[model samples]
Target: MSKRRFIAALIGVLVAPLLTVVMPAGTASAHGWITSPASRQEQCRAGTVSCGEIKYEPQSVEGPKGLRNCHGNVGRFAELNNDGKGWRVQNVSRTTTFRWNLTARHRTSTWEYYIGGARVASFNDGGAIPGSTVTHNVNLGRTGRQKLLAIWNIADTANAFYVCVDLNIS
Candidate 1:
């Protein structure tokens, strides 16, 4: 099967069984929460999650019980046109096993993953970089909120790539 089809099939397989767990059917779907724009550069004036901005400028929201609201603000270096290659965020999820699905184009540049404002994983070091849809799992236990900033920096200068995340609260 083609890569695209394979990704679709994989997503179907992964989400199909998840649908069986009834959540008392209600207006609010109990699935993972996703912000709009689906990209950092896109203008998303809605949602409790705001990206592409420095300093903890977040939109408030009612998160699930035990699931703290994650507000990620890229550091000044992470801002567009910044020369430095470092990115940072303030308090996100103080303590939790946060899993996020990052849909990005498969490339050679290093793709880092963070949760609650700390570095958790990277996709260049044998990490899977799905050109279509891919999920990165990070388990942050007993860690402070300052440990959840995931950065995907390119070793070489290149056009900014779109990175969208879907957070699943357990």
Candidate 2:
């Protein structure tokens, strides 16, 4: 190749990846966390559990919908998937109120709560934007120490946000 053409091609190859890194697809416009019951990320953020990079971005455990684990299937926050991480199990009542603190609200499809892989409760939003703080009074029918999974499904995106809370239900 000619000198000028070769240099231009080299620059193009070098800058393309940089541009991709600089501007990733589907930038996160909205994020939230289960703040009341203290999800695994919250435990990391509160220093109750020694965790990894998830402590820095607790509200970013985002992944595809229908995932059953904590960390939202994201590798950086994989520490959340460790059930033996000594997460503080908060004592709660049979009917507990779960709260979410949103950084930026999105059109929500629904909010689901699960225990032992079974959905205990869900509130359908029908694709409506929610407030900064959302609450759901869910009847966690079962008792004893349980790992509860909460999911925030976005209406317009193929991804969903996930958080897991260790609860000692009475």
Candidate 3:
């Protein structure tokens, strides 16, 4: 083959794999959210409520694990943390099941649920990779309306995803 043609072929071989490695397929699908009882983001995704950019990518609200804000501290998803955004509260039993719809599973540290200002339930994953779908049954143990915060902690990362769910328990 000609030297110029050989050089061009070599460049393609080197650059093609780097491009794939830099941007792997489905890397955008790297997390999830609580779908059951519908977190605010889920409500946006389902058209139960109007929202901003989060409506397009509800599973992407990742932030530090210890914070108590929605949008996972992401400014673009800040609408999720808004109190007067007209989110519909879902009615549930005292004991309700939360379902996580995971697009990409990661090694998880824990899953925590909080109501008002108190932690009511937590599941420890012990650094194991979780399934695409996860469910947790939480005993709310109280009646009336409440706002719930659900957190998914990643074992290997310094971040977690957050979801704020409104509920009316009976």
What stretches of model 2 exceed 4 Å from their correct place? 1-30
Q: Which candidate comes out best when scored by TM-score?
A: 3
- Per-residue error (Å), model 2, residue 79: 0.6
lDDT tens string, model 2, 81-164?
Answer: 999889999999999999898888889999999999899999999999999999999999999999999999999999899999
Candidate 3 residue-wise lDDT at 150: 91
**lDDT at residue 32 of model 1 (Cα atoms):** 21
| lDDT score at residue 64, model 1, on the 0-100 scale | 20
Pitting candidate 1 against candidate 2, the one with the higher lDDT is 2
How do the residues 26-51 of candidate 3 rate in per-residue lDDT, one tens digit apiece?
A: 54775899899888989999988988
Candidate lDDT (C-alpha), each:
0.35, 0.91, 0.90
Q: Judged by TM-score relative to the true structure, which candidate is superior, 2 or 3?
A: 3
Model 1 poorest ten-residue lDDT run? 28-37
